[model samples]
Target: MTSLPPQEFTSVARAEAPLDENRGFACHVLIIGGGASGTLMALHLLNASPDMRVTVIEKSALLGCGIAYSTTDPGHLLNTRVHNMSAYPDRPEHFRDWLRQSGMAPGATDESFVGRQIYGRYLNDLIARERDLPEVSRLRCVKDECLRLEETPKAVIAHLGDGTCIRGDRAILATGHAVPVQSHAVLTSGWDFTPPADPGQPVVIIGTGLSMIDHLITLLRNGHRGTITCVSRRGLLPQVHTETKPLAISRGHVPLGAPVSAILHWMRGLAADAERQGGTWRDAVDGIRAHVSAIWRAWPEAERRRFLRHAASFWEVHRHRVPPDSARWLQEARDRGQLRILRGRFEEATMGEDGLIAVRIRTSGGERVLPAGRAVDCRGIRRDPAKDSAPVIQDLLARGQSRLDPLKLGIDTNEWAQVLLADGRPSRRLFAIGPCARGAAWEITAIPDIRVQCAELARHLHAIEAQDPVGVSRG
Candidate 1:
């Protein structure tokens, strides 16, 4: 068994299941994955019902910080502003207030964008404070990976990697980003940037999205002198964040269920109108941020595929933005000939005779090979979860309890965040949120979207629990 780490500002304390012979009886909620999504779900459940109990099963000792927020780099500022990144949508200033009192960012404002590590600290503080609450001491943070889940007549049993089994009334799949864990040779992951032996040696990145920008920021801030090349189909970069009021848009005005082509034309007109009215396209895009999921839900599978084929890249560049300072650094790097953007598609990577990584990419004209000291796959968030997702997800897929959506963007899920079985039926006991259920919502990767989903799911679960009067074993 991997012994749980002692609790600290960053580490989470673990609680094992009771060793009673009847331990298979019902518990309240088993929230798998202790990243931001799981933590939010737990908190909302606790608030929804006075006696609700939550057990969070997470492999990593870092409680609330997942791969995204676990970065130790000081240069990684959050793409979203503090005003909109709160854990609670009703309390828009919750994170801002925490930042002020936590002593980490005493001077942070609503508009200020801080380091991702700092936000991770904020999430950790929430968990720590909740743990200290004796009156509501129902949340259990377990440091173990859930291998698989089995459904019973009354409860859901989760089998952990350490050979421990825990039963709950419900199991939530909050494993945020499908982290790519397997090792590779020629190409490295964008998540973990390993510094090359020679900083002067050229580096090639395989995507021009936000992830690529993150690599660039890290390299530039660390004083890397090599010429960096970023390659993608269109070489489109995320729009830079600027101070402008988001245009107020009504849901009725949005053309939900429209074709991808129609939606594109409508959005372009909206942006043009925003510019004519003294604002920029950013304001117009931001206006429809909350309605993105609704628009996505309205679309059928054919339209959704059309979006992925044609408009997904364009929408991402507009929706997911880069912070001001990072954008400035990137532009300056380009102006100084330290950065190069290539419009092409990454083909493959192989070791070259000169001991450098040779990255092959196909352009409009032809294919070419670029030799570099290191090549990193900065292919943004959409990873093949079938091969690279966390073990629990893989086990679910294999067991026919869950399957990847038709697009294979993520696990198949209904609108309510319920994991769909391979036979096209929703599982009553198993639920997935965040990136694991990406097929359900287009804009759910952001904190604002995820927190809302968590709150709503908790309420739904609470209602179901209230209907079932069966209580869990106290022992």
Candidate 2:
């Protein structure tokens, strides 16, 4: 129920100059995608030095509310606890303090799992504060999709879908996760769902992950009394967070630069040790958070693929935990026979004469037929952006402005998050962060990791601008 500060945004003007390499650009920073990552990067840039100007272009009608926090459902709670949800890592208690100050939670606790919408509001407020600063700092938000980018030595010209082109000295591709992919019987992804006409009609949920829980909670709250079947390859659900002090990794225990199997073995040993010491495995998982990026980077190409293929599922289930309340709700649903979890692969789907959906699944033993009035795919976010329908991304790849990672999980970027061209050359004017930069930093999606990236990137840009202010000239 807390009210957020009013956002004051100015319109960004398209460059009037012709698309010539001789032209100079006016904008200092060009951020594509006004999601959480882009917003934070802008904030960091302005805060580091007030002399910079930023323009954020987003396809969404709304800014700040990316796919993660765009949900209006109260049931969609933040997976991370309130204390650890701060936008800035330096101010660790920033989010919790804001909750209390805003009167959203008079006395917020560390374990509080607030609605994700509230976090989105916090982001909007944070960005607004940064934008309100005095002279030498200007931030504009453009509501349009960036279709293509033409990078020259002097500047980067971003072409918008509406025939508007803007030029900036540097561009950061903060485009978040791609549109979720549809699976066998499911036609779409995420929390979008329409309840069947019959409240008692059965439902099948493909992939038992966070998305599945979101759909399940929504259905149950909407008075659904039918059986719910969740099907996945391993039927693995995220572990629940418990109230325990997280412990750091003991010295020399976490194996860095090791193979996937060795890393998994090390983690298991650490988890067991933590359990023996009256701490939970969650603590052990949290301990490894700081090193995951390095570990992934240290891994050889084969080891990286090995981790993705053999250990990703188990690691994800343990690392990204659900709220305790959600876990209990799921347990209760299963105990009452209202929910069922099965390990299987989706083979095919058909429409039955009874107007039901018949799904053929390949289980451990044999094939089985499951019928449901409706189905939803909760298989998680689409890691590969090349598989998406984003015109801008397609254009980038087609023009060789950007290339896919070796693993094809995301765009190719170097260690510093600079986007690499198809020819394996890093672009001085192009950078990437968040999910798109996952290829560079395997753990770059979360707030803790992204905030660091923003700080570093802002510093790097500031240094570059200081060295040659007239280098990226605006004529």
In Å, residue 221's CA in model 1 sits off its true spot by: 1.8
Clashes of each: 0, 0
Q: Point out where model 2 deviates above 4 Å.
A: 1-27, 132-137, 181-186, 250-253, 468-475
Winning candidate number (lDDT)? 1
> Which sections of candidate 1 miss by over 4 Å?
1-8, 14-27, 181-184, 469-475
lDDT of each: 0.82, 0.78
Residue 236 displacement in candidate 2 (angstroms): 0.7
lDDT for each residue of candidate 1 in 1-475, tens digit (9 for 90 to 100): 1112234355664553472223332247889999888888887887777767788888888878888887767788899999988888889999999989876678989999998877777787787777767653777777889999998767788998889888777789999887665355778888876567789999999889888888898888777999899999999998899997788999999999899899889889989999999999988999988789999999999999999998898899989898998899889999999899999988889898899988898999899998899898888665688987888889889989999998898888887788889998888788899987898897788888999999998777676665663421110
Model 2's TM-score against the true structure: 0.91
lDDT, candidate 2, 1-475, per-residue tens: 3323324222233332233222232347888988888888888887777667787888775566678877766677888888787877778788999889977676788779988777877777777665555643377767789999889877888999889788787889888877755555444355575666788988988889888988888788779999999999998998888876566765466677877888888888878888999998887789888888889988888999988888888888888889987888899999999999999998777789988888789999999999988877677777557866366767889989889889987888887678888999888788888887687778887777888889898887787676665342111
Using all chains and alpha carbons, the TM-scores for the candidates as numbered come to: 0.94, 0.91
> Lowest lDDT 10-mer window, candidate 2?
8-17
In model 1, what is the error at residue 62, expressed in angstroms? 0.9
